[model samples]
Target: MKKNLFRSSSLILLVILMNGCIRGYTPDVVLKKDGQPCISIPADEDFFRRQKEFNILGLDIFQTGVGELWSRHYLDSKDHYYVKNQQCLYFNYKFQTNILYDISFFSTEKGDEENRKSTKKVWMRYMRIIKKSDGTLQLLLDKEARDYY
Candidate 1:
């Protein structure tokens, strides 16, 4: 009995020690001077070209994976975040009565106007994702979105 108890406890302690030594996954997040978490990737291309196809991918990513990252950061669901790829991305995902994701991918706010452009790089000021009545997903950037999903 004594031998069994000692062996079991030793094994448990060794497992615990090994687990602690393993590191947790840390996302590649850059902190702004104002303490905002942002993804530092290049935003050189257009917001939603190719008939709003890019917006659809972004929306799908947010729903599945990006949203998980946002939750892990403990950010407010209602509050939007930013990504600095020189273009500026003030983004947010809202899952209220209607799922809404508005990512200001081309413009910056009043405070960080000098860091980037205050006005939109493209004609469409905002990149919004929407679902069509046909049960298919689509992106609504502006008047042009009416033609696409």
Candidate 2:
């Protein structure tokens, strides 16, 4: 009975350890124009007006790729693992719009040599703010994206 219990515990521990390195999603932070929450990266009225001087703001494109240089150099190399150009996002936040912020997602790592390669899955976050009414800013996690908008 003791042996069986030890085996079960070991299995559970293994599962937990394996999942420890996995990357997850960032919750959405979106509010109506009525304004409930404040903005984290705040700007001024002139900042808003200038941003609207142009009808089309700008395009923010994010490209993610992975693989060793040598492996990717060849026509086909099965030795390496890769995740390339996984996602692309385009958005515009005009000054006239009532949106306080626009948020996107990305994944990254810090202080880990083993994670040097860009092969790991990541969620990149993009945020664009139109205006901020209140001086207070709060970080929130929700179904849309995770940020303080």
Candidate 3:
């Protein structure tokens, strides 16, 4: 019983510390009149640290990977291990339209070596912000869309 309590406390502490590290950043959105899906990098380091870990682990660990050598790299949101994208974001669903906005970042390290460090774009999943209305919004998850959006 005590052992389980300790584990839970430790996990809670770990989560709190992590939330502290990624708190100061807010992602940017650009509205294009034409309205088609577009993927682009955040153009700075603050966004890199804000990407929420999809399931396995947070992507901020890779912040070390964005050194002088790389400009931006491709991140496939479909991979679902690192991208901060969540399918059913509810906070601002009502205010949004059908157009999707792009949120981006990448890079990292492990032990004494680089994990997914890249100087050029690599194939990764895109974190998109699609509008709730406009009928143009299509879900990659299909039926699962109703649960969230």
User: Which candidate number maximizes lDDT?
Assistant: 3
Q: lDDT tens string, model 2, 52-142? A: 1111111222211211111011112232222112112223222222322323222222222244334222232333333446643333333
Decreasing TM-score order of the candidates:
1, 3, 2
Score each candidate by Cα lDDT: 0.31, 0.29, 0.31
lDDT for each residue of candidate 3 in 8-115, tens digit (9 for 90 to 100): 456435544644442323333333354432332344533566543332222221111121111232244443333333222111112233322222233332121233
**lDDT at position 142, candidate 3:** 22
Best by TM-score, which number? 1
lDDT of 1 by residue, 5-45 (tens): 56545643543463343222111223344433343233433
Weakest ten-residue segment in model 2 by summed lDDT: 66-75
Each model's TM-score, in the order given? 0.23, 0.20, 0.22
- Kindly state the number of residue pairs that clash in model 3: 14
Model 1 C-alpha lDDT versus the unseen true structure? 0.31
Between candidates 2 and 3, which one is better according to TM-score?
3
The list of candidate 2 runs beyond 4 A from truth reads 1-24, 28-96, 99-102, 113-149
Error of 1 at 57 (Å): 26
